[model samples]
Target chain A: MTGYLNIILRLTIWFLLTADLSWANIVIGVGVTILLPRGVTNVGLLKDWLRTLGEVAVAIPQAYKEAFEIMLYPHREETVVLERVKPRRTPSLIFLDIFLITFTPKTIVQRYHSRGWYEVHYIQRRETP
Target chain B: MINILSYTCIILGLVFWYWGTWPLLGRRSVLYKLHGLSVADTLGSMAIVVGLLLRIPHEWPLLVLALISLSIWNTVLGYVLAYCVTDDGTHDVGQEVGHGG
Candidate 1:
């Protein structure tokens, strides 16, 4: 199922790039997508996948909000903190987690330790009081 | 109505671009600057693409693909950059301390 989805995604990009729908184009798109090397499939839980997608959706709005906040208050303090990664997460899920974290303006993943900890760099508005 | 909205989006994206890039001139750490750059560049570029899409509905497929790639590629590139810089900084600090002692 995932393999088919991957092929479909690649073909979609191919068609978009070429902006064509002829039979010849379809055949060529399929050939290219199939010939591409596939990554190791780490079968992650469906629930986790849904959660990651939800996070991605949420990140868009959150990103806007954070951008506004940063623009409003430019004074900030920076710190490095270690965050624990959920156990048994697939590599793709982990990549999604990192992406979601870094998508916002105030935090970024600096490193992923082998022991399930992410070295996260954070920014916070400094109070003027 | 669509013309006004697209123009608004394009202007908003330009503002984001400026806001994000302005930090590079400040004395903040590299990571802080990167956070601003990545967030602004990705969101701003997406907004601009969306504006173009609204103006030219016939190019929906290409604009949508641009949006997808912008979000994913920018985020991953930011991560890779942050990782590389910090990794190198730590190694350099270690070497500096070794030489100092």
Candidate 2:
């Protein structure tokens, strides 16, 4: 499933870049996607993938809100907290998790400990009640 | 209506860009500055691309691609920067300072 998704993602990028729908273009896109080297394949659950997607969608609005909060409160308190990674997450999902955490303004994953912990840097308004 | 909306988005994106970037001038930890930079750079740029898409519907594919890549690349870059900087013994220093302040 991940492999198919990878192919589709590459094909979408190729189509967008070329802005072409010709048979030749489609053939070349497919050829390139096939030729591209993929790393170790980890079979991740589709349920996990969908949940990550939902988090991504939710993060957009939350990001905007966080941005506003950061802007309003320039003076912030910073701290590093150890966060646990969800059990059985594939590499792609782990990558997505890190991305989602860092995408927001309030927190960033500083380091990923091999023992399923993320050293997350968090920021918040100093005057928060 | 669309024109106004697109302009608003573009302007809003610019505001976010500044909001996120202005913190770099502060005397804060690297991670703090990175948080602001990543949020602004990625989200602001995405907003600008979204506005462009609204203005030029004909170029939806390219603009959409831009949005996707911008978010993914910026987020990854932020994580990489944070990871690299904190890997050394500097993390202890940062922790101490954070607690002190």
Candidate 3:
């Protein structure tokens, strides 16, 4: 729809603050998105999208809490990343780590249950010895 | 040249995050699922990093610090996300490449 086109155009302008082929590519991307809108665009992409939107509307508080935990203490976590590394239970800790990492800016949950050792990649080496 | 690339990346990333992903997941998607980051995550955040790298003044330590944290998290989140998307006993029911809705 025309509404989508207008939004893309504005984004193009934002990118154009610096002049280069990068900007040109960005503009082209915007134009393409406008011309070929898909997925849950236009509030009518699918029934699933609507259901998802409603669910997300309800999940804000939990998400916010998780974000808070990750941000407040980003230093190396005290908990063992893998059970083999330290003999603690994992389900709860791994779940908490995942939620926390997702919201916080510096950390992320990389992989779980790989070759019998839980693994993750950190953006920084704070936790690594 | 850097400025241009950075700005272009920022715009592209923002579009996918705000317009592209927002409609499907709404605000919840922003929460960072950590399972499968989606192409949007890396593309959008890298755009941000490139854009910020171009404009930031050396005196603005606070801004740089914040942006640094953001970029790191984006990468971590995306790597986790990709794992989750392709992990065992699960399947992407909707919105993957080369598939119909």
Instruction: Give the candidate number with the greatest lDDT.
Output: 2
TM-score of chain A of 2: 0.87
What is candidate 1's local distance difference test score?
A: 0.80
Model 3: which residue pairs collide? Answer: B9-B47, B13-B44, B35-B81, B35-B84, B36-B81, B37-B81
Q: Model 2: residues >4 Å from true position, as ranges?
A: A1-5, A127-129, B88-101
The per-prediction tally of clashing pairs is 0, 0, 6
User: Which candidate order results from sorting by lDDT in descending order?
Assistant: 2, 1, 3
Query: Which candidate wins on DockQ?
Result: 2
Clashing pairs in 2: none
- lDDT for each residue of candidate 2 in A12-111, tens digit (9 for 90 to 100): 8999999989999989998999888987577688888888889999999999888887777774677677778999988878888998998887888888
lDDT, candidate 3, B47-67, per-residue tens: 565577677654244444544
Which has the better TM-score: candidate 1, or candidate 2? 2
DockQ (0 to 1) for model 3: 0.07
Query: B79 in model 3: Cα distance from truth in Å?
Result: 7.8
Judged by whole-model lDDT over C-alpha atoms, candidate 3 comes out at 0.43
- The two-chain DockQ for each candidate, comma-separated, is 0.34, 0.47, 0.07
Please write out the lDDT profile of model 1 over residues A1-129, one tens digit for every residue.
344336656987899889989999989998999888888656678888788888889999999888888788774766666688988987867878998998887878888887688877777675222
Model 3 chain B weakest 10-residue run by lDDT? B92-101
Q: Report lDDT (CA) for all predictions.
A: 0.80, 0.82, 0.43
Candidate order by TM-score, decreasing, is 2, 1, 3
Question: Candidate 1, residue A79: CA error in Å?
Answer: 1.2
